[model samples]
Target: MKKIFVLDTNVLLQDPNAIYAFEDNEVVIPAIVLEEIDNKKRNADELGRNARQISRMMDGLRNQGRLFEGIDLPNGGRLKVELNHRSFAKLQETFAEGTNDNRILAVALNYHMEEQENPNPRPVVMVSKDTLVRIKADVLGLTAQDYLTDRIVNMPDMYMGYLTIHAHPSVIDEFYTYRYLNVNSLHLAYPLNPHEFVILKDEMGTSKSALLKVNADGKKLEPLFLSNDPIWGIGARNAQQRMALELLLNDEIPIVTLTGKAGTGKTLLTLAAGLLKVEDERKYKKLLIARPVVPMGKDIGYLPGEKEEKLRPWMQPIYDNLEYLFDTKKAGDIEKILAGLGSIQVEALTYIRGRSIPGQFIIIDEAQNLSKHEVKTIVSRVGEGSKIVLLGDPEQIDHPYLDASSNGLTYVVERFKAQNISGHITLERGERSHLAQLAADLL
Candidate 1:
């Protein structure tokens, strides 16, 4: 049976196309929902963009029929603004001001009670992204649910950028003797993304381990067993760091996303690989890096100095990576190399809004702070033959509207995992220092 769903303001703010996503089911928009959308329509963040999108969608639907009563949707569902709800009971007794939330709850209550009075009652469900709203619905004896259209993964299944694989009985023998194995030797499950990491164990599922990368067909691609120690200089303190280098070094996979705790080598490895590709290999034309300049919990006011000094705090990490890559002898020598390269440019993501970048290596750090709309804007700016790497940990996100699962990093992982042009990895190791990894794990 077709059910009726009452949408909350947070639902629309979280995802603009949520209304149409509940296809073939009747979707009800509370009268108070419009007031909430109107209040958020002026802001510049993700919520404001979604509110504006919902407004435009509603306006376009006016051509079909009356929204106040009801209108037929393209996907075979009906939408209308609830008019029979007055919220006198919920407001006079529970809340004093008849807030939009209380008004929405009142609509759900009215619908549920109406269904109860019918001979063949259809289910009335209230959908929201607010935990408080769901709790309030429970208090009022109503069924509530989370609007989950935008979540890329649950907490457990989110890409940590690495995974351990127990090798077969002869896998270790093959790696030790041959130093490399064909893609068919490893019997991995189907549908593995290109450049994803895997650990080859000693058949016993423990002992004498080796890290490898998967080709497009889930084959053992990288077997960097060059008779010795790991890449100590680049800092693979954890197994995931070893995995990160496998992705960073491979040129076949154009796109990669690295998410990890603080002090991880996410920025360092990407910048290092980018330098190798542009300067040494001449594989790409330029090395471009950009990030949102959102300050730590506040705005960065004007700084009275040169451009480098003005952007010091926001771009400090990027500068540090350049300094390391150049092996600068003097204090200000890194900047000289940057000027000499001429191909390396650090611009704000805002400036990339209108330009088309091709045949370059682009890295967007602190990407977890971006909204779905903002990330879309940045990714669409990529032209032909360019590799755009998005690196950021959603756990360290600073955006108010984004969480671990709702941010653009996870969104991209969920949306593009199946495509051939994109690839992703979640760096689990903190290669900064022993203390850094300890703090990330225990503290």
Candidate 2:
């Protein structure tokens, strides 16, 4: 049966080509959605770019006929700008003054109810990016769905890029004794992502032991060099950890991005790699680490004391990682290291703008908090002979305008992965305490 898809403004803002995504399904653009798009089109960001793209698409369609009325889309569905629907009557009982969401709902309700009365009726599905709007659709008894095309992956299943395998007891022995196993031979359930972790279980025994990682190939993976352990003194806990270490240790791929849950070692690996490159390989002259001060916005509110003092809290985790790396036993040991090393600098991302960095090993933590535009700006600042790593999990992102799929970190990974100079790995499994892993999974 033919179906009608009513798109929300946010869906278009998130991805302008959303209209073409419905394939053969009829597309109904609520009149209010245009107004919302018009309001956001002037902004200078990804959303604005998408809005303009949508405008251009609508313009291109204008040649076929008036898009405001009805036009045939390339996907074999009719594109329409809905101006009237009888469902507005239902809104009168629920909302005295109609809000935009209510109006969009009214359009879907009108269509659904009218179709129900039709001898031959079609399905009407409301497509939106807002969770609340979808919830309201259920209350109104209309079908609702997220515009899933913009998502980086299909589901939470993308967490570690997933791979499961069973190995003879020998693989576990190789993992503990060799501390690394061949990349092949494990025969992962899923194709191995460069830094993807795997849990190798004893296929036969219920009480059999587990091997955290045995590498993707049957080659001896790099051992955890004591020098490369996170400042916290912990190493990669599983196969994914070793994979992450391999990617981090290699100097050829100048840009690497790591995305994983907290304790999956995203930050730890980046820091460890940066330290290894700077202190051991001399691949770069300095190791510079920085993170966005803003969790959601660019705002850094005024704080007491000096600039560094105000930044201390935002940079605390970075310091903690550094402290662990240095094995600072005394209370002030880390501060002293920071004073002497001078090679390592922890600062806010705000200061990074307009600075041309060269011959440095740079690690940008919490990169998911950065906007696509902001990321472009930061990456462009790199001069020749520099390696910059951007690390963060999209699911754990705090950026208001970006989701896991569209955030700067994911954006960078997708955009750069094809290039020989760049690589990406999504870490799975938490090396943190079992409780932390449980929280990541359930909560």
TM-scores vs. true structure, each candidate: 0.83, 0.74
Go through the candidates in order and give each one's C-alpha lDDT: 0.77, 0.75
lDDT per residue (tens digit) for residues 1-443 in model 2: 89999998898877777888988888999988888888878864456677888888888888998776799887788899887665577867866568888898889889888899999989999999888989988888899998877666544544443255667878777777767776665654434444334566677775555434223342333343433354335576766666667667767667878888887878877887788778777888898898987642344556788888888889999988788778889887898887887888887888887799999998999998876667898999987899888888788876555677767777687666445566566777887689998999999
For candidate 1, write residues 1-443 as lDDT tens digits: 98999999888887888889888889999978988899989865566778899999999989988888899888999898887565457434665666778788888888888898999988989898778889988887888998877777896888654567677758767776876677667765654565566676776745677776655655456664322233323546566666666666666667778887878888887887787778878888999998887622233336778766777777878888787767778888877888987989986665566689999999999998887778888888887878888988788877755678888877787787666556677776666788999999897
Q: List the residue pairs that clash in candidate 1.
A: 160-426, 161-426
- Give me the displacement of residue 69 in model 2, in angstroms: 1.1
Candidate 1: 10-residue stretch with minimal lDDT: 224-233
Model 2: how far is 430 from its true place, Å? 4.9
The local lDDT score (0 to 100) that residue 378 gets in candidate 2 is: 92
Worst 10 residues of 2 by lDDT: 213-222
